[model samples]
Structures are given as C-alpha cells and as structure tokens.
Target: MLSPDKVSAHADEDWENAGAGDTIDVERLVAVVRRQWRIVAVCMGIFAILGLVYILTAVPKYTASTSVLIDRGNSQIANQMQASVAAALPIEDDASVLSEVELFKSDSIGLAVVDKLKLLDIPEFTSPARSPISMLRSLLNFRTWFASDDVAADDIDTLRHNAADKIVADMDVDRIGRSYALSISYTSTSPELASKIATSIAEAYLVDKLNSKYDATRRASEWLQERIDELKQKALDSDLAVQKFRTAHGLLSTGGQYQLLSDQQLSELTTQLIGAQADTARARAKYERVKSIIDNKRTDAIVTDVLDNSISNDLRKKYLEASKLEAEISARLGPDHVQAVRLRSEMAEYQRLMFEELNRIAESYQSELQVAQTREKSLQDSVTQASSVTAAAGETQVQLRELERTADTYRNLYQTFLARFQEATQQQSFPITDARIITRAQVPTAPSAPKKPLILALAMALGAAFGGAIGAFREYRDRFFRTGEQVRDVLSLEYIGHVPAIDAKEAGSGNKDPESVRGLQNGNGITNYVVNHPLSAFAETMRSAKIAVDMENTSTRCKVIGVISCLPGEGKSTIAVNLAQLLAMQGSRTLLIDADLRNPGATRAIGRHAEQGILEVLLEGRPLKDVLLLDNKTKLAFLPAVVKRRVPHSSDLLSSSIMVNMLDELKAHFDYIVLDLPPLGPVVDARAISPMLDASLAVIEWGRTSRRVVRTTFAVQPEVMQKCIGVVLNKVDTEKLKLYRSYGSGEYYYNRYSAYYHEA
Candidate 1:
C-alpha cells in the first residue's frame, strides 16, 4: 500500500511518461468510428438517394460523330507549283491541324450549318428548354420589369443567332493524335437530328474552305492581271526610250551583233594602220641598205631586195670569179703579170656594174618608201579620226546601258507576272480544299449520359469522405475522461473504478423485498444499490475507493474523505453515499455528511425529509446526533444539509472554525467520514474544506466532463488536488464504454470478469 505522498510521486512519474510525446493511436481512431458509425451511415444513405434522384430525373442525350481528314496530299501538286511562282503556303503541322479543329468549332461554320439546315425551324433549336437561371428570371418577371415595351422578343435574326450559339455549345471538336484528322461530335435528344447536325457542320467547314480558297485565288488573279497590263506598258515604253536614246547619241549598234558602229570603224582603222606601218618599215630598211652599199662602194654588203635583182646577182658572181683568177696569177707570176692586171681590171668593172644596178634598186626603194609612208600617214589620220568618234560614243554609253537595263528588267517582270496570272486563273477555275470527309456522321443507337452506377459510387465516396471529416472533428473535440488510462494520464491520479448508473425503474424491477422496494419508489435506489447488489460492479467500485483511501491515509486515525467534482451533475453525492454505505456494511463506523450548503444533492437522495441538518449543527450549535439519520440495513449515519433558503457564502461556511470543530468532534465517533461537497469548477467550498480532509475522491462523469476543466479546477485548488487520493469515473454506460476500451485497461477485460458480479 502506498502513502499519499508516494502515490503522488508515482502519479508524477506517470504524468511525465504520458507527456513525453504525442503520436497517432490507431485504436483510438477505431474507437471513434465505432462510436459514430450511425452518422456515417446516415450521410451515405442521403447522398445515395440524391444520386438516384438525379439519375431518374436526368434527360438522356444521343451523340453523333464524324471524322474529317486534312488531306494535304490532294493539294501537294498545286502547292508545289504555286510555291515556285509565289510565297509558299505554310507546311501542315500539329499546330495547323489543331487550328483546323478549332475552325470546325468556329462561329462561321456553326452559323453556316444553322442556316443551311434551317435549324431555327426545329423545335429543339427555336424552343429549347430553359436553363435553371432563365427559369428563375422568368419566375421573377425581371425582363418585363427592366425592358422597354418597344423591345421585340425572339426576332428572326436573334433566333438565328441563338440557334447558332446552341449548335456551337452542343458541338465537340478535337484532333486525332499526331495525324491530320479531326473528330467532330454533337449531342441532341434526337439521334437523327444529332447525326444531321454533325454532318452539316463538317460539310459547312469543307465548303467554307473551298469558298475561301476560291475567293482568295480570284482576288489574286485580278491583282495579277492589273499588274501584268501595267508592266507590259512600262516594258514597251522602256524599249522605245532605249532605241530613241541610242539613235540620238550616234551609238547605233551593228545588225545581228549589238556592237556600236563607231567601235567597229575604230577596230578596222587600227588593223589597216598596223599593216601600212609594217610595209613602210620594210621599204625604209631596203632603201637605207642600198644607199649604204652605194655610198661606201663596198661589194660585200648583201640586201634581200637587191639580191632578188637578177642583174646585180650576175655582176656579183662575175666579180667573185675574176677575184679568184687574180689571186692565182699573182701567186704564180712575178711582179706585174699581164693576166693578174687584166683580172683585177675585170673585177673593178664588175663592181662598177653591180653599183649601177644597186643605184637603180635604191631609186625604186625610195619611191616605194615614199608611197608606203604616204599610205601610213593617211591610215594614221583615219585612225585618229575614228578614235575621236569612238571616244565620244563611249561617253554616251552609260545612259544607254541604264536605259537598256531598265528595259530588260521590265521585260522580265512582265513575263513573271504573266505566268503568275495564268496560275491564279487556273486555281480559280479548279479550286480544291485540303479537308475531306473520312467518316460520315451516323445516328447513335443508345443514350450516352447519366451513368447511374458511376454517379452513385461517386456520391457514396463523397459522402464517406464528408462523414470521415465530421468524425475526425468529433474526435478532436472529445477531450474527456473515458477510462482509467485517461485518469492516470491526464490528471495523474489513481483511477478508483467506474460507478455504473442505476436507473430507478431498473432498481425497482429487480427488487422483490419490501425494504428494497420502498427504497426504489423513493428514488433512493442508487444510494442503496451497494447494499442491494453487494456483488455487483457498483458495489465493487465502492470497495476499490475504500481501498485507495486506506492506502493513502494508512497512518491517519480518522480518514475524512471528501467526494468532489469539477462540474455539477457529476454524481459526487451518489459516490459519497454509496462509499459510506459500503464501509458501514463491512462493519466500520462510517459517517456521510452533505457538506454542499447551496445544492444538497446527497440530502435530497437519502435524507430529503430531514427537518434540520449540517447548517443547524454548524450555525445553531445543534448536536450531530440530533440531526444525523441512521440507515438500519448498513448501520450508516448521515448528516444532510436542509437549506430553507439560498446560502450565498457557501465557501465561507465550509471553511469556518465551526465546521472544522464539528468534523473534529465527529471524527472521534466515526472511523471514516465522507463529505459530499460542491463542485470545484463553480464554487470554492470543496477547496476551502480540503485542508480538513485526510483524502479526497474526484468524481468525474465518464465521456462528458472535459479534461481541461478538471485540470483547471485542480490547478486553482492545489490543496484539494494534493489531498485527492484518486479519481472515480461516474455514471458509466457499460455498453458504450466497451467502445473506449484499450489494451491494459480495466474495462478491456470487463467481459471476462463480468460473471463474478450478481445484480439480481
């Protein structure tokens, strides 16, 4: 058995252990779900019903689908040819395909389909069902109130526009993978109408493409024709200007070859002058050679022109023969031979004849030289004249070249535009679109909306999620005592036991004896329950409280125990009365006192008919024996508080010297004294009388009282908390308590030990 100090130290150690850390407890979560399972079921059932209602009320719609392939292959030839003559069209890509998909959903296509299909005449388009917001506005008559009387309702144009908008709203368009294919789908109540609308939208898109291309080509052709005419006139004007400028500047070109006449004349004059200069140089050389041979009278010098003269060649041959004979005669004969003299005279005569012939040739060379010089001078004069005329023509050639280049550019442009004009004309006549129908829209066989099972499943899942959230909130706020573990962990006090609530009806139904029957009829069943059901859990809990009191005050002669609570209606008076009865039944002299002067619940339960009680004993000096009521079965004495009027100063009365002396005097007659005190939360009467108590028992309502309130109550009343031996969880519902059971707790094994208690 532990003393109060040792018990307190042990509680402190347990508190430290409990406060070490907070972690998730799976058992606690299971317990919470068990306690709130009904709420979850109710929420799930409501959501399921709503889902079913929606499914039953929803209108089913049929969907029709059509596929359009963007056939770039069909336009490849035209695009390639057009690219050579103009800016190339952009190549088809993912972005271009997606753009085509968007075009299928555009307002232009939608409006075209609406008009072509005469959708405004159909009931689904013209007189469609009103939306919830529109219905609400109609109910309020807001349009009539805000609009002018002159405003027309549902005009033809407005109806057509609305039909177009409705068509667009019901349509879905998307690209199919990376390929150049578009999928268009539409939904409506009628399968045939859905198919018709989808097909009409696709047809409208393709037709719109063809019409756009045709219009663009026609415009391009008209512009190209205008440009061709303008370029043709400009090319003709440039050609005429070039011809007129050339003729005015005397820069006429040679026929067939476009060379200027002045340049040809200069070229011919330069060639002839070169020939004349060569002839003059030859004639002058011949004349100089003949003159040198005649002036020096030398016969050794040779000239080609003189050599070609036959008379000069013969004379030179004869002179050579004679000189040879003269040399031989002079060598054979002495001083002056007649033959040598004769041969030398003959060589002289031959030299004279050759000189005469050379003179004649020189005269002819001089005449030829004069003629050649005259011809060279005449050609030089002609070349100088041609050079001056060519130089003048060269100066004027810059402007002529400019005019000629301008003419050539205009001519090329004219030809290019002429080709472009022809291509555009061809395109306008035979227009082609890039898109074609791959799969025509077909009527759907079945409705495509309002999946009942999926909706119901989703609704149930949402409901479960919502219910779980609420359950989590309830668990977060459930900070109250439920088991002995909570008492030990939260308040750090030994948990005595649970005092199960005994109803008046149940108490009377079990009892057959007159005394037990009388106690049940008077609402004193709970106070006398320990005596009637001695082997029951209620009686067993009272025995446990007694044991805790004994252990805490082992050395004390008189144990004055106070039964207190944090808040009102916690059944402290019942615990006090039952504990005292249990002590007296075990052959101990026990005295139960109703110490709460303001609300004497113990006196009302066991001593309600008493005339005077603790007030008389404390204020009027009445003897305790005179006001005490005796229980015949248990031999227990009770002191009840019979308040005739409101007692404002309840705490002052409990802490008074008269009350202390009265307790001290009663201690000599009683082995154990149990006081039913007011709650510590609202009043300080329990704390005021705490110093006189040997041990105190805190009575807390199971799962109803908050741990924070109880802790605050003890914190404010430190003396009461120090004297408190343990805590008792009162009014426990055994069935509900099972949900809060945890491992190692007293209630966890209650089912196994429940057979030991006999209530009937």
Candidate 2:
C-alpha cells in the first residue's frame, strides 16, 4: 500500500511523461516567447522604421466634392401627360437613387468634363498613358531594328479609353441615404483641377438632362403638327361633300330631324287625309240627328249644329213674332177678315222657311261629307305613292349620315392635335432638368491621403505577429535535452538526477596535484568531487545517482554498473568516478573502472601514467591489481585503461571472454563496480560489454546533446537498452534553470528546494 503523497507523486510523473510527447504546452510557448522578446522587439522596430519612411515619401492627393439635388421633376411631368396610356411606375426607391449615382459617375459625364476642361491637352491625364510595365517592355525591345516605336491606332484608342476609365474610377458618387441628393467627388494631385472637374461634371449632367427633354418635346410637336394638318383637310373635304349631296337631292336642311323631299310630301298628305276623315265623321253625325227628328216627331229636340248657328237663331226669333201677331188678329175678327188671314199666312210662311233652312243645312252637311270622302281617298293615294319614294331614298340618307360621322371625327381630331401642338411648343421653348447642382466644388485646403498613424499601427501589429511566429519556430527547432524530465520523457528512460555545472575553479575532482588540476580541461576531474564537496549541490547530485543505481539493482551480492554516453564530452566518466567514490565514502566496496580504451578521460583524470591496464589484463593475462589505482583519501579503487597497443576493433576486445571473466571476478569482491565506458555513438563498446554488466546508465549533457542521438542508440541495441538503468542530466546550469519556470525539473524540484541546501 502507498501513501497519498506517493500515489500523487506517481500520478504526477505519469502526467509529465505523457506531456513530453509531440504535444506543446501553452506555458512553455509563453516562456519561449518571453525568452526571445529582444528579437521580437528588434523586428518590430525595423517594421516601424519602414512604415515611417513610407509615410514620409508617399504622395499627397486632394479631393473635391460637389452636391447635386435630384428631384422627381421630369418623371412627374411625363407621368401626368401619359397617365391614361402609360403603366403606373413605382415611386423612386434606393435602387433608383443608386442608378442616379451610377449616372453621375458614368462615361458621358467623364467625356463632357474632358471636353469642357480640355483634359486631353493636360499632361496629367494624357501624357504617358501606357502603363509603366508596358512602357518598360517597349523600351527593352527598342534595340531591334524592326521594333516599332509608333503606337498602333487601336492602342492609342485603348489608352484614351483607359484614361477615361481612370477618370470614372477616381470619381465617387454616393447618394445621401434615402434623400434625393448626391455627393459627387473626384481626387487629383492638383486641387484646382479636382474642383473644376467636380463642378463641370454636375453642370454637364444638367445640360444632358435638358437636352433629353428638348428632344422629346420636339418629336411631340412635329408629330402633332402633321396630324393637325391632315385632320383639317379631311374635315373640310367631308363638309363640302355633304353640301354637294344635299343640293343634288334638294333636301337642304341644317338640322338632323329635317327630312328629304319625298318624306315631307308623305307627311303633308297624311295630315290632309286625317282632316278629311274628321269632316266626314261630323257630317254623318248631323245627318243621323235630322233623321231621328223627322222619324220620331221630336221637333223640339235641336241638333248641336243648329244650336251653334247664327241663322237658325234669327229664324227662331221671327217665328215667335209671327205667332204673337196671329193671336192678336184672331181676337179682332171672327173668320173671313182680310187682315187676320194675312197674319196667319205670314206665320205659316215663317214656319215653312224654318223647315227649309233645317233641311238645307242637312243637305249641305251630306254634300260636304261626300266631297271629304273623295278628297280623303285622293290624299290617301298620294300619301301611299310618296311613302314608296321615301323608302327608295332611305339608302342615300344612310350614306349621308356616314359621311357626317366621318366629318365629325376629323374635326374632333384636328382640335385635339391643335391643343397638344400648342402645349409641346411651349415646353420646347423652356425646358426643365430633373437634377441641379446644390453645392459647387471648391479647391481643397489640405491633402487627403497617406494616413501615417494608421499605417504605423498596422506595421507594428504585423511585426509582432511575425516575431511570435519566429519565436515558435526557434522553440520547435531546438531538439536537445534541457532537463532531467526530458531524458525520461523524450527517451523513455528513468531519470536519476541532474548534476549542477561545476565552476572552473572547483571542477578538478581527481587532480590532487595542483599542476594536474591546472592542466585538466576546465579542471573537470571530479573523481573525488563527492568527498571534497559533500554538502555541495553537485555532490548531492552524485549521491542521488548512487541511490538510483542501488535502487535499480536487484542482485543480492554486487551491482556491476556501466556508465555510458551517447556522445563524447558528455561527462560520463566524471559522473561514474564521482558516483563510485561517493559509494565508497558511504562504506560500500566500490570499484571505478575506466574501461574506455579509446580516449581514456578517467585514466588521465586520476593522474595514472600506467601504459597497461584493462587491455593488458585481458590480452596478456596480467593481474588486475598491477594496473589498478586506488584513491587513498576515500579508499575508492579504479582500474584505468592504459594504451599498450593500438587495437583496430576495441568493441570486439571489450566483448572478449577474458574481459567478462575479469568483470565477473571483480563483481564478487566489490559491493558496486562502476565502469566508465566510451561514448556509444562512435563505437559499439558499451553495447558489446552491456551483457556482461548487470545494468547500464546513460549520461546526457544538459542543454547540449540531442535526444534523438541517445534514443536512436538505444533503439539499435535493444539488449543494451533493456540492461540500461536510466539517465543522468549532467552539467545543468542551476541559476539559468531557475529563470526558466517552464522546465519541469527546475520549476518543480530544483528551484523549489534550492534554498534547503547549504554550500560546501
């Protein structure tokens, strides 16, 4: 069972191991950026300077703007006139405003401005119209005799087109929101020219509009005039034809109800026949009244005609006078008197006259009725004859009515044309435009280009981005080991400890003689380093290596520990020697063997001048004690290799049965035998003897050797890798590691516990 601390420690180690693969940590990236800040600053400064230079050298341009008010004028007038005929158009929207804006920037305006200002005469717009690249090519081809310097006609036209296109491109036309106003602007090097061009474009647009309206009015007037003349002639000819037709038929009446001659005769005869019929009816009624008076003897009942007659009234008066006379005479004489008889005779004569009058009146009525009947019959016959003639003339009347209708149409057309013609003439004389210039352009007071501050800020931002990229690249490019964690993680090996770099003055570990220490490289002979500086961080690191080796060994008696390196100058010998001495000081019988026949650094470090050591023992059967050097102070023993003969294959010699036998024999006497072998990179000596040793340890120079080299070596020799105990990250700069908080060993272990240790 493990404690919580132990379990946490194991988990943390596993986490760190997992993180050491291809995955990059954010903290490490930030650290790398911080470490390379000086480079980033330099790059930013350079970019800023370039921006400053451009801001100083860039050309300045002036912009001029003109405002135009565009009303729905012409469209309104057109709509009013064509209301009944034309389709109703939608009110102007954003698209209509944009169309106007495009018109303001169109080539027509450009051409007009060019002509008005004589832009072709100006060098700015016309000279060197060909692009610089094209001109350069033409110049380059000038050495050939047949190379034409004359521009083609089409090319000249194209150049002019490009110039016009440039003018349009430089002009900006923007509608002010939804309002009917446009802001037209142009940019140029010359302020006055820019202003002039802006103003001219606005004026030109107005003139073009007026011209369009005038043309439309002229067309309408011409069409109306021609139509009016044709209508007047047609009306005159129709009226004359109608008059001629009336004269020929003798039916001349100006009103529509008037009839032809035959129709009038028929109407008069019919009226006469109706009068005759009324007379005949009255006469018959009178005759019937007389008959009733005579047959029924009702003399007192008078006829209506007699009552209405003046002669009958007079006759009735006379009869009454006579009867009065008769009565007087009878009273005077009896019967035979002459006077009385005359009176009676007068009365009787009056009565006879009254009867005769009544009879004559009746006869006169009868005769009048007969005459009326004869007249009615004749009139009836005449009416029938006239009706036949009128029917025959009905077709002619239809023809005449058609001619009258045609004449009315012509007259009406003439009146309409005349009215429209007058209107068109008035409009043509005074034309109106839809758009007018609201604000005239003026010469600009200040240049409007090459924004300096904005350019500088952008340059700085770009520089920072590029610098960060460079920093990231540098971090990825560095593939060497920097901490103990890297040795374990990158190479998948156990990490023992990391040895702090020894100062030059304290690094001569095995050189007991002052002269030998001075002669050593950086005075790095650290064979007695643990004994001399027991309390120092370097010595503590060596103790840590010893502990790791002890913990890794499972054998009961002895552990044959082989110290190897992937490359030379990695401090493997120093680590092995110091580790063995540290074990000896702890009362372990340890032997430090310098088994590297090639470049024996340990042999030289201990000041051993013996010409024969492991090589002589293995080849000549020399006893090991004869070449073994023992440290008297720490009682540590080491067998140093002396070069007695140059062997071609050192790895083969190290793998010999004799050397294995010697190592086996020594293993029984010592508690721990540490062998410092040659680096495994240039030769296979370590791999050759790895089977003979119990375990092997690799020494990697911190921040120096590449992890790939070590990992590849182990990969090639699986047996050696299996026998390998782990690695020690040697020659670490402890002070530098403290600054790099991202380094796992430094941040979590060394820096945290640095104050706990005291200096030797």
Candidate 3:
C-alpha cells in the first residue's frame, strides 16, 4: 500500500532509467524468441516447402564451357609483314584481355555463330523455351492491353537477329585472373546444344578475327597499289622535268659533275687574268727604268738588263779605257797634243755606242710591256664574258635543283609504296589471328542451376529473417503487463498478486450445494471462490488484496475499497467479489456492491437473481437491507445494480450525495466495502466517487491490458490513482506467464511458493 504522491515519486525514480529501454536486452530478446519460436518455425517450414516446389518444377539448364587463349604472338608474323600498311596489333594486357572477353560475347560473334550453325532453322534457337516465371510475366504484361491486333510478325532477318541476341544473352565470357585466357560458357536446355553453341562462339570469334585481318590487308593492298602507280608516274614526270629544265637553261655539266661548263670557264679565266695583271705590272716597271737610262744618257748608271747585254758591256768597257787614256795624254803633254786628240775621239765613239745599246734595251722593254698589257686585257675580257654566262646559268640552276629534288622525293615514295604493296599482298594471302580455341566445349552431364539444397537453405534463411521481423514488431507492440514487476515499475503501485484464470468446468467442480451456487449465479465459481477454496492461489490473491486495503486504511474502522480496471473484461468484478468474500470469510464484515451501473458485471455474476439492487435503493429510496443479498456461508452482503434502461449519466449518479451517504451507511456495518466500478478508461464513475472511497484496487489483465491504457486512465483520473492501494494482475495463464518472468519478479519465484497453495 502506498500514497499516490509516494507512488508517483517512486514511478518517476523507476523512469529515470527508462532510456535504457532503447538498448538491447539479451534476456528480453531470449524471452521474445522463446515465446515466438513457433511462429518462426511455421514461417520457415512454409518457405522451405515453397523452395522445394520451385526446385521440382523448374527446368534444368546445362552449362557447357570452352576456353580460348589469346596469343598476341600469333599475329606477330602478319604484323611484321603489314607493318608499313597497317598498325601493329595491340599486345595483351589485363584491359586488352578483358576486351577480348567482351568481344567474345559481342553480338557480331553471336550473329556469326548463328549464321554458321543455321540457328534460324532450329526452333529451340529461334524461339527459346521460356521459364514458368517468364511465362507468368508474359501473361501479366500490361503492354498487351494497349498493343494493336495488327502487329506484324518477325521476318526471317528479325528472327535471326533475335536468335543471335538470345545467344549473346545466354553467353558468359570471363577472363582468367591476370591472364589472356578467356572462358566461354553457354547455357541451354539441351547439353549438346549448349556445348555446340559454346564451341561455335569460340570458332566464330577466331573466324571473325581472321576475316577482319584479311579484309584490312586486302583494302590496304589495293590502296597501296593505287598509290604506287601514281607515285611511279610522278617519279618519271619529275625526272623528265629536271632534264628538260637543264637543257632549256644550257646548264650542261661535264664528266658527270654537277658544275656547269660556263662556271668552270669563269673560274679558270679569273685565275689567268690575275697572273697576266701581275706580269703586266712587272713589264711596265722594267720599260720605264730602261727609257729613263737612255733619255738621260745615264751610261754610268748600272741596269740589270743593260749590264747583262754583251755589246753594252763591251762598249762601256771601251769608253772607260779611252777616257782614261785621254786624261793621261792631256796631263803629260799639252792640251793640243796629237795622241791626246786620238784618245778623245775614241772615248766619244764608245759613248755613242753605249747610248745606242741603251736605246735598244729600252725598245725591247717597251715591246715586252705592250705584249703583257695586251694579254692582260684579253684575259679580262674573257673573264667578263664567262662571268655573264655563269651568272645566267646560276638562276636556271635553282629551277633545275628544285626539279631534281621533286624527282628524288617521288622516286623514294614509289619505292616505299612498292615495298608496302608487296607486304600488303603477303598479309592478305597469309591472314593470321591472335585468338584460338584451346579447349573444345564438352557436353555437361549435370544441370548447373536450381541448386536444391542451397536454394532451400536460402529460402529458410529468408523466412527466418521475415519471421524475426514480425516477431520484433510484435515485441515492439507488446506494451502490456505480463508480470507483477510490470505493475510496480510501470504504475508504481504495490503489486498484490496475480489471479489465475479459472475455467468454467473447474469453477463448478467440487461444489456440494449446486443450488446455492446457482442461486448466487456463481457458475464460474469466481464470486465465492475464496469460500469454496480458501487455500487456492486465487483465494490467496484475494487475501493479498485485503491486506493491501487494510494497510492503506489502518486508521479507519471500515475500508471502502473500489475495485477498478482500465478496460472492461479485465476481471475487476470477479476480483471485487472474491476480495469481499475473503474478508467476510476471515470474520470481517464485508459488503460487495455492484456500483457499475452501466455494465454491472458483479451484479450479473453473483446477484443476478435479486429483483432490486443499488439502483432501486438510490433512486426509489428503498431500504439497503431490503435489497441486499447475503451469502450465508461467508455472511457477505451483495448490492446488485439493476438497470431497466440505459444509464448515460452513471458517473453523476455514482458521485451523488445519495450514493455517498448510502456508502457511508454501509461502511458503518461493514469492516470492508468492495465496490465494482466501471473501467476508468470508458467512464468517469470510478473517479467521480473516488473522493468518498478509502482506497482503490486496480485489476489489470495479464498480457492483454496495455500499460499505456492504464497509465492514461490514471492520468485522466488522478484522484482515483491517488487512492489506488495496489494492482492485481488478473486472468493470467500460468504456463505462458513463465516466459515473461524477469529476474527478481514475484513470478520468478512462483514455483518455490507454489507448494503451499492447493485447490479443494
């Protein structure tokens, strides 16, 4: 027993750790699993059966596989031959190998295989077998509703394309790890067909590669031939232009030298003119010196040329001797001596002869100067003529050189293209590919799909997951009181005890006075259960309720306790009848009143035979003693509620001054007054008269009544909740209740104390 404020404070303290509800609780989870295991098992069994059915009905498909090795080196020979005309094939890498795998599964390869194998003729290939699921999908197709009836059927080409697409769709191509080997697999209903298609795919891929290479080489060869012919003609034309230009310009070369004849002549003339100029300068200088000697009569002056002349030297010598002889005769004799006169004449003759020799030398020097000057002038004229011819040829040589360069370029192109054409022809003749089938596809003996065990296992797992989800949802929604701990923790009210549900058969059994039980309308034996079996658990729970009432109202002589619940069907009426009986059986004066004017469950249970009840006493001013029905064995007085019609304002009637005074009068004669009030959730009668009541006992259906509804009921009727002494969990299934037993809860130790209680 606890006051409302103390209970509220205690509830708040319990709620301090309410956030912990969000965390995972292992024991709670185990309890939920234990309670819901049957649901999970049923769901799993259903799924497993479905999986088995699917496996049995599904069509078997055989997958045949073949391996193809991509040998890039196989094409090296062709690559080398066609290197000039075509680019080299790419070397195999991870990406390239994967590209090959994709190519193997390409529509082109599929189409090629289809055509070679004449797949269009085969019905299986043209119109493949559809699975049940596919057929069902076709049946449910929404597009068919909108489609026109005049839609054209597929033609032969379209059928072929469809067959090829089907082949590609069913084909799988995978490259082995980090290798150039590709695994080609095909799935089909027939093993042979699967093997044939897989093998055909590999062969078709190789054939496609070969055809591609051959076509490329053929095209390259034709192009190279056209280029080679064009270049040959261009080479010939360029050579002809070079010769023609050389001839037009008269730029003739000698001895196979590139230099023109006019240029050689200019060079030779320039050298000769330089030598002639030098000779002319020397001759002029000699001629001037000799003339000066002759004119000035410088016989005493020594000239190299004059001195070399024999006559001049002889004449000079004779003159020198004669002068010497003249000088001696003049000095020895007189100036007019005859011998001196002869010497003088001889000297004069010698001088004249020397002068004549000097003149001759001068004339010879003049002749040599004239000859040298003439030669120099002739050489200069030749050089000037050659320079003019060479200058004109130089301008023409520029055009000749350009024509020669063009001829050389065309010739080189022709040779290169000619070589490329040969290589292209060779490549076209000897076509090669990089892919080859290393392992031929073989027919598979076993089906590759619809693995029974794995599918069943997966189905079971899926079912378990779905079941677990449903169980979790149920657990999330299970916000009901299942144990006494829930009542204490959720509502913060003292937990009295749980009343086990009594079946009708068990309630009527072991009763000697059937008429007396019938008169009290105790067919379920719930109203007088404590009188029949005081040692039973149900009767014991009543005692606990009585104890709670007595504890809460220790100061009062008579405790007026109202038995209420949040909702109907929670056994509040049964609880009130049993509690009153237990008090009366224990030698305490007890009065059981059915104050629930709306439903009157207690009146229907134990006072159904009474003609008048609490309603008659209240509205008609009837005496309470006249309407009271007393149990002879327990001496418990029962006040029934008889409603002739609907009572809409039941709460107003229950809270009236007449009702309060009636209860006060009954309390004077009874030690405990138990009133069966209407559930607080649907009516306010319980809360309206709660001010006059000493205490209230809340009866909650175990695992059925929601904790939220009870809390809300109390929240709306705080006065009733404040006077609430304790809560009794009613209508409990003891077997199932064990699953919800938490540690430190009353139910957790129910088994240990169960030996003390027995039904009569």
Instruction: List pairs with backbone clashes in candidate 2.
Output: 509-525
Record all residue pairs in model 1 with backbone atoms less than 3 Å apart, i.e. clashing.
none
| Descending-TM-score candidate ranking | 1, 3, 2
lDDT by residue for model 3 (1-760), tens:
4766766777685775486677887888788998888778888999999999999998899999999987867677667766644544675467677667778767789789888889878888765458798788877989877877763555566877889889988998887777778899999989999999999998999898898888887898889888888998999999898888777766666778566788888888999999999999999998888787777877688889876889988888888887888888899996689988988888888888888888887889899999999999999999999988888777777877788889999999999888888777777766678778899999899999878899999999988988888888888998999887677777778888899988867777422344553235565676777778789999888888787777777899988888999999988988898888889889998888898999999888877777888888988999987888777777888888988889878889989999989987887798888889999988788889999889999999988988998887777888988888888988999999988986666778989999999986
Q: Per lDDT, what order, best first? A: 1, 3, 2
Show model 3 residue runs off by greater than 4 Å.
1-23, 80-94, 127-154, 216-426, 509-519
Q: Name the 10 consecutive residues with the lowest summed lDDT in model 1.
A: 512-521
Error of 2 at 448 (Å): 2.7
lDDT, candidate 2, 401-507, per-residue tens: 88778878888888878877877776665555667788999999898767788889988887887887787786677688876556655666666677888765665
TM-score for all predictions?
0.71, 0.60, 0.71
Model 1 accuracy (lDDT, Cα): 0.84
Give, for candidate 3, the lowest lDDT window spanning 10 residues. 510-519
Cα deviation of 556, candidate 3, in Å: 1.7
Candidates 2 and 3 compared: the better one by lDDT is 3
Q: Candidate 1: which stretches are off by over 4 Å?
A: 1-25, 80-94, 128-133, 139-154, 215-425, 509-524
Clashes of each: 0, 1, 0
Error of 3 at 751 (Å): 3.4
